[model samples]
Target: MADETNNPDLEVNAASVSDGAYTLIIADFSDTDMAWEAYETLKSVEDGRSVEIEGVIVVRRTTEGRLEIQKATDHSTKSGLKWGVVGGIALGVIFPPSILGSAAVAGGAGAIVGKLRQRHHNHELEQKLENAITPGHSGLLALVSDPGEIKIRKALERAETIVESTLEQVEADDIKAAAKEVQGAHA
Candidate 1:
């Protein structure tokens, strides 16, 4: 679940990047409680596999479709034809077109490898993109890390559309000013 509280000062957030930790802007929930709830949901997903997401920060965007990201998380997994056949068989049951049925059968021999590979990247990238956007509100999801943040950040930059990035500093005043401008324009 994502926080969708509307804030007049949605863009009044800044990014702080250091050698150890990074700052991410995300949506501003109604209160600390809602933010904490969303954080818990994300934290609980660490079953040891997915790129260890340290935390999730929500910054509201005054603009409609802007996603500001810092460090991107790259998650790539590989599988062979066997998995594709198994998957295609399952899919064919749901989609019973003549071509699709034949494709599913042929996939058993390894034709589905390309399909699965494409799907794998698509799924991973799509998940990251979704994480960046809120359900209703428009904004960005900043993912910060220490040494390993580079790879993650690159993956995000490649996959996402609108990304604004800057070093974190005591620049909340500037951000607040920018937020005011955005709000005024939108209003």
Candidate 2:
């Protein structure tokens, strides 16, 4: 007889996600500095009450044609840190520091890709993110759960940033592949 308790699929399905609804927002900036500024601005904005931000990552292509990924170390917004933790953990699974090379990595990042794999799946978001951030430019990718579009928009507007591409209901696999692809290019 099979040990049902040992079934990986069942275990994954049992894992609970604090929030199910999420939107992947990829905002491009004129420069890497602007992208980091926008990311900080978004983290500082008081829009969490209306929207739950699960995670945020910044991607930039250097003039030398290399890719860099950065995750938030400290977030100011409500649940920003919480979601940032989740995002960090997820990223740990997708892009370990060894593979990341010189790219910055956050604390508490672990191999939890198995957990994320159970919750989300889609590569299009990653592809879009890779395409949107070009050399000399930067992009901010965020995973927000059930946000009030208007409020988030207003917050971003206040930060003086604009969205390049927005994909709602993204999956973990998509994010993983994208990160992998970016890391792969450099490797």
Candidate 3:
């Protein structure tokens, strides 16, 4: 059900990764620094062979309330498509459609997407995202083999708010494909 981390800074949190679906974890932190710290910690743990993470992304709402991807891995092309699937789905889910293009479609926060979503999904993941990382906060999004992985437990503990969801690979692929289509249209 859970895996413990030897690192004192982290602790076991919940179920580890799943087999038929991907476990996406979004953790909100008061500051971007903390979020980034957790991201690094996750990677470090994976490097030590303590766990396996498909991908990790750090997202933040700037002081202006715009959603921005502070850090993301693009290894889907280099390592394997599986490596970046989680992050891709996250960006596709959270980024407002206006931000997909050059303009915000509204007056404000030119650096990040400002909440005018072009499309919608039936799932409550959108609302969950809104609650997990409010404006001006930071978040860590990760896809782990198991949510119970010690490294995952430890990193997620750093977040002030955490939300966990499971999605079949096809669902995630749909999200990614949709996002890419939007990006392509903008391009």
How many residue pairs clash per model?
10, 3, 7
lDDT agreement with native, every candidate: 0.31, 0.47, 0.55
What tens digits encode model 2's per-residue C-alpha lDDT throughout 134-166? 466665656666444554554443222333333
All candidates: TM-score: 0.22, 0.54, 0.62
Best-fitting candidate, scored by TM-score: 3
Root-mean-square deviation per candidate = 20.5, 14.6, 6.9
- Displacement of the residue 48 alpha carbon in candidate 1, Å: 4.3
Q: Give stretches of model 2 more than 4 Å off.
A: 1-20, 70-73, 76-84, 88-105, 108-110, 114-121, 157-187
What would the TM-score be for candidate 1 when compared with the true structure?
0.22
TM-score of 2: 0.54
Superposed model 1: Cα runs more than 4 Å off: 1-23, 55-187
Flag regions of model 3 displaced more than 4 Å. 1-20, 47-50, 71-86, 94-120, 173-187
Question: Hey, what RMSD does candidate 2 come out at?
Answer: 14.6
Residues 62-179 of candidate 3 have per-residue lDDT tens digits of 6666666663444432223333344644555554443232322212222222221233342455554555566778877776546767657766676766677665675555544543
The Cα error of candidate 1 at residue 123, in Å, is 35
